[model samples]
Target: MMMTPADLDAFAIGFMLTERLADSTRDVLSVEPFEAEAGWIVRVTLADRCRGRIHDRVRHRTSDTGCGLCGIASLEQLRRPVAHIPPRPRSGARALFSAIAALRDHQPLNGATGAVHAAAACAPDGTIVAAYEDVGRHNALDKLIGATAACGVPGFILVTSRISFEMADKALVASTPMLVGISAPTTLAVDHARAHGLTLVALARADAMLVLNDPWNCFDAVAGEGLEPPTPGL
Candidate 1:
């Protein structure tokens, strides 16, 4: 995996959990990082209970920063089962908009470099409780997931990048009910989110957001709200 050299511990923990290499944090014993001639390396020690999940498969090359499903050897590997998200009370549009507005304040790294992506965990009322940033969008979300693992999943997760199948899958793995993306979502992501009961929203701004999937009515719908859709073929 090619990722920014920050929050490696979180990345390790999150990667373990999201990939189902370890069922929970209890399955992880330790995460240690060391300097290498090429770059930093993180060594994750999983408990004996997770021994069965370990594999010897190797990637031919480093994963690109924009793509997460890079090293899979077969189409079946990308079809991992997603856990269904239980239904929750509908989140108000006010809260969603509030979170969108507040997300900018939590992105210190992006503010400094103007190149990093951010992922944030927000409360039901739209207060951001935790946030993480990285050059890779997936890495940012992984860091946020690992950072908040002890507290359980948050009300929702917000990302500063387009929602792809991998991003939606990560949110599903974390059991987050809703995922709000600042940009649009891919069609595969929308289909997967609908199938797994994830409330997927995208094209979000301080004023509006488009609801691509809401199988469980996770977001309160405003009848006849004049929100413009993205351009055709987007």
Candidate 2:
């Protein structure tokens, strides 16, 4: 479509879920462009049963770049609670470190735009299984979550952006055990990770990185001592 974002596949699916645009991925029958007086609008064809749940009349909203979190109209939606954290089922921080090291391979879309964020799932073997890239970091994570919901939770998430509370919320929803990134984290991200039992690995370089959450459960210890993540690079 004329107005489609460069990352349409990911953006469409991600926006649908994160905005409560549809109940599931299948609800979106197709997406195309609609010429309007203001500009082109993307009209999504939803399943007939879901037609009334979400109206087609979209009210214009404004925000700065990277400010896609404004759709939260309800307190419950704004601050969704995570389920209690589960026990860490994997061993060895080596697996996580390897995933962080391999984050570059997951940026197929980012390689094109240099403006997209990515979220990838890595097996303990350190190979990326699935990656979703979007204009928004949280949306990227949500796309990864929606795609991975049935495959069962994996070892961790490799994000191409900094960790934030909303990122933590998406990871928790996917039941992902840990999040590794080439960036640092927000204070809220750290607290949410600890609260929900998800490991937060940040400031990852090729050789080393930091585990910035609850060390007792997150660290394998077998991989050695943990440290706080350094500041993120812009």
Candidate 3:
């Protein structure tokens, strides 16, 4: 899940915005180089309304399925502390369908290694805004968030992997509010998405998708008529 410092920026932004952790979705206030264990630490400033949304945070890396869970007996970790989302309008199916299809074309890393996981932010018109790939799915998301923090705002994020708890946590930390995944999401992911005001969509592809938590956002599109929505187990 290792990536260059520059790549991590994009991971953070994509992870946050696509996951609906960031309502502002603005650019980074500033990016100062650091010598911490992680490549760098980013400081993002939000609008007046979103400023107070963040109080304290616990940041850590989630690499595997085991890393993104509760009661793991980790030294210091969260028991899933997240706020609620206000239910923003859902993104249309036509838009999502096109974005996911076109996302692969922009994946430079996957072009080389099909095994790598990718993440991207796309414009409303299906234009690929920013893209990043990493060995691990969570790292790809972290890079997306970092990228969004440095660069301008992105419309949404798309992941090549399944929606998991770590993905939800990273999105919450970034404060963006929309996440789309190629596969299904776990119960923990859905719970966190609802608590943190995130719109989590899973199994989105050619003609189908699911809305595990739509309170923060919905998928409204004329082209979505024939497509069936995914059913959350809970």
TM-score of each: 0.90, 0.70, 0.66
Q: Please, what are the lDDT tens digits per residue for candidate 2 over residues 1-234?
A: 212244455455555554555656678788675557976466677788876656542424542235344544544544654555744646345666677677777787778768788888888666789888767677677667667654745677788888877777667666666778778888888887787778777876766677677545545453354533334342
In the order shown, what is each candidate's alpha-carbon RMSD? 2.8, 5.0, 6.3
Off by over 4 Å in 2: 1-68, 71-77, 83-91, 220-234
Order the candidates by lDDT, highest first: 1, 2, 3
- Quickly count the clashes in candidate 2: 0
- Backbone clash pairs for candidate 1 read none
Cα lDDT, model 2, residue 108: 75
**Considering lDDT, which of the candidate structures 1 and 3 is the better prediction for this target?**
1
| Candidate 3 local distance difference test against the native | 0.62
Runs off by more than 4 Å, candidate 3: 1-76, 80-90, 150-154, 220-234
Write the residue-wise lDDT of candidate 1 on 50-154 in tens digits: 887667334456777866778767667767776556456245566678889888899888898899999999887788889999999999999988888888555
lDDT assessment of candidate 1: 0.81
- Candidate 3 per-residue lDDT, tens place, 1-234, comes to 244455544554554444344543463343334557855565544455544434433234433423444333453444644543423534566667888888878877778868688777766555678777777777777776666655532355678888888887776655455778888788888987877778777888766677676663355434365665543442
